[model samples]
Target: MDDSTVDRLAAELYQVSQTGKPVAHLTKRYPDITIDDAYAIQLAGRKLREADGRKGVGAKIGLTSVVMQQLFNVYEPDYGYIMDDMVVMENEPVKMSEHFVPRVEAEIAFLLKKPLEGPGISVADVLRATEGIMPCLEIIDTRYEAGTMKVEDSIADIASIGKVVLGGALTSAKEIDLRYTGLVFEKNGEIISTAAGAAVLGHPAASVAWLANKLASYGVSLRKGDLIISGSLIAACSVEAGDAVRATFDRLGSVSARFK
Candidate 1:
């Protein structure tokens, strides 16, 4: 797509997000669009948010699991920026009326203490960067109309990220075997899904390393104090109004949210 078209699509997506109105899939209308173009659109949307005073807090990785890859028919993971306004406190109520097609997933979040810019970042490097890790729940919402989105479309929609809730348990990464860390998601007192940190591209830290390397290609770097939410441990579950969602991690405690 041309620059003008990319800008127009980015504006349309931003408008859709603000209005809670769904739009047609960009890939469905522009089949020739490439992943690079999709990322450009994402950046455009990020620029809009920044201009509107929504600071970039961190980033979220998507499609990191084999299950998600197969479901989307994509072989690699994608990522998106996380804005300050997207952070919700644990046990807080998220107004469903403010989102479109919202869903939730359980994951781990990395709070960085040092800058990480990578062409070849390793999981060990990610852990060594210091700070701590927290169990997290990512709320995903898409501006694209359901059932018509492609990988490119998802990328342009900022990987469909909406909000995030961070758990209170903050532990050093060096203290735990994150690969074996386990998670269980519950909705209204019923166990809905279960997974382990290994589900996230083999290890949760590996996902952060991947993000560091991937962002380097776009001239971006993970900075100190940045809160990076690694890929989901389990598949996302659809959420509705009046629902209570909770995720319990074996050693990381639990985080919860109420939809209203």
Candidate 2:
């Protein structure tokens, strides 16, 4: 897509975000939209938000799991920026009124202590740069109406990420094996799903490594202090007002979020 077209689409997304009214799927309207066009539109939207005062803290990776890949019909993972405004304190109530269609997923978050610049970044490099790992809940909110939202539509809508809730104590990756880490997802005090860290591209750190290399192609690097949520360990569950969600990770503690 052209610059003007990208800007127009970004503006539409911005408007929808403010009004909580989703628009039609982008891929449906723009059948020829490519991954590059989608990222360009996402970047344009990020610029618009930054101009309005939101700061980019880090990025979120999605679709690293085979289930998520099949659900989205995308063969590879996608990444999106995490704005400072998108963070909610652990145990805080997420304002459901502010989101269009929110769903929650469990993930392992990586807080980088050193910059990772890469064309060939590996999981070992990611582990070495890690500051700590925290159990997290990623709220997925898509600005497009349900149906036929391909990877293109998702990437354009910031990988459908809404908000993040971080909890648990920070622990070094060297102290534990992420691939063997287990997670239990609870909704309203009932267990809804369970998964192991290996569910995410055989290991969560591998997902972060993938993001670093992916960003390197665009001349971007994962900088020190940046937080990256390695893709979801379990499938995302829909959330509504009065709902309570928590994710308990073995060796990583737990994080919770309430919808109100």
Candidate 3:
């Protein structure tokens, strides 16, 4: 709620991230914390990461689907900045030891070629920005005790973002009907879920549009070359050492990660 309190919580999160130890839920202790205060804590965490030499790549959207929203008891999506250091090479094995507790989700990533800012940004505007989309896997590692986080706690914890793995060839946004694009999510060589891009807020582009408009309210804009990860098409799956996860898209090829 206050600047000092926000910084303290952010520092606690930053410390846990480094030590791979989760802290207690923030909201359970600070019940009166507003969404604005949560975002302020997120911003403070961003500044702390930047100070540590991590550059902001773009942002990731979460809870984009009505199902996820209802599960979280929220009507809108939440977001967090994506840092360059959060990306892992497509062929690399993710070291689980570096994270507190991570779960993976499949997503479509939008690579913007033009700036998009708004209070009224639309899916059409997002597509017209002219770039492409790629298959991606987002690793959401919450820095809080398991099953103890509330929506505000998640917001302050950088929306539970951990690392990201991107693969697949980039395809022009105009060339594909994202709503019809489908994905087969797999874990340890078995199919886990099957979903379409429509699972992410009707169309993946719509998620990006929502992100752009939401960012505008915080005095942020989607810049050229920013890679926006639309929310997951499938539910988050817990991953452990020796496990493998992959998402194969209908036209976007596939991306995989092995945990070790």
Candidate 4:
């Protein structure tokens, strides 16, 4: 695709994301479309990047949940960038108008004290590189209308990231057996589901390792202070207005967010 072709698709994508309209994935129409091609179009829709206007602090994992795998019909997870502006304190209410068809998921977030870059990164590397871990809520909304997305289309849509909420700070990554750290998700005082730090590709840190290597392929690197959201422990729930969501980890405390 030419520069104009990429830009045109991106612009259309951004319009729908910001306006809460929907779009169909071009790949579904043209199965021959490569992920690279899809990215060109999706990045062209860079409305979120423009709105936040902050440096990319980290990345988030998508399609990691078994439920999402079933929903999206893919086994591997996709990724998106997280900006400084998207980071907010947990337990606060977010306006509903901010996202287009937004949904929520529970995750374990890690603040990296050291950088991890690699063609061959390991799980131990992720554990040693972290400053600490915390509970996080991931907000997912599409840039296009409800449509099937190719890898590149999702990437260009900035990995379909909408917003993030962080809470329940831990003293250190080593404080708990992060891989087995288990918890339940509750909404409005009812137990909705469960997830463990282990559910995230074995450990949340491993997700960071995956992010680091994945970004390196595109000439990006993980930097110090990057708040990496490993992957969802539980399923992505269809969020509605007035819903109060919280995740309570076994050893760690709880983090909550409300939609308004």
Clashing pairs in 3: none
Off by over 4 Å in 1: none
Full candidate order by TM-score, most accurate first: 3, 2, 1, 4
Model 3 off-target regions past 4 Å? none
lDDT by candidate, in order shown: 0.91, 0.93, 0.91, 0.76
The reply for model 4, stretches above 4 Å from the true place, is: 17-20, 28-30, 41-52, 65-75, 147-152
Q: Which pairs of residues clash in candidate 2, taking residues 3 or more apart in a chain or in different chains?
A: none
Q: Candidates 1 and 4: which is better by TM-score?
A: 1
Per-candidate TM-score against the hidden true structure? 0.97, 0.97, 0.97, 0.87
Evaluation by TM-score, superior candidate among 1 and 3: 3
Q: Could you give candidate 2's per-residue lDDT for residues 51-88 as a string of tens digits?
A: 99999999999999787788877788999999999999
Best by lDDT: 2
lDDT of 3: 0.91
- Per-prediction tally of clashes: 0, 0, 0, 5
Query: What digit string (tens of lDDT, one per residue) describes model 1 on residues 81-130?
Result: 99999999886789887798899999999999999999899999999995
Candidate 2 residues lying further than 4 Å off, grouped into runs, are none
**Deviation in Å, model 1, residue 19 alpha carbon:** 2.3
> Residue 223 deviation, candidate 2, in Å?
0.8
lDDT of 2 at 72: 75
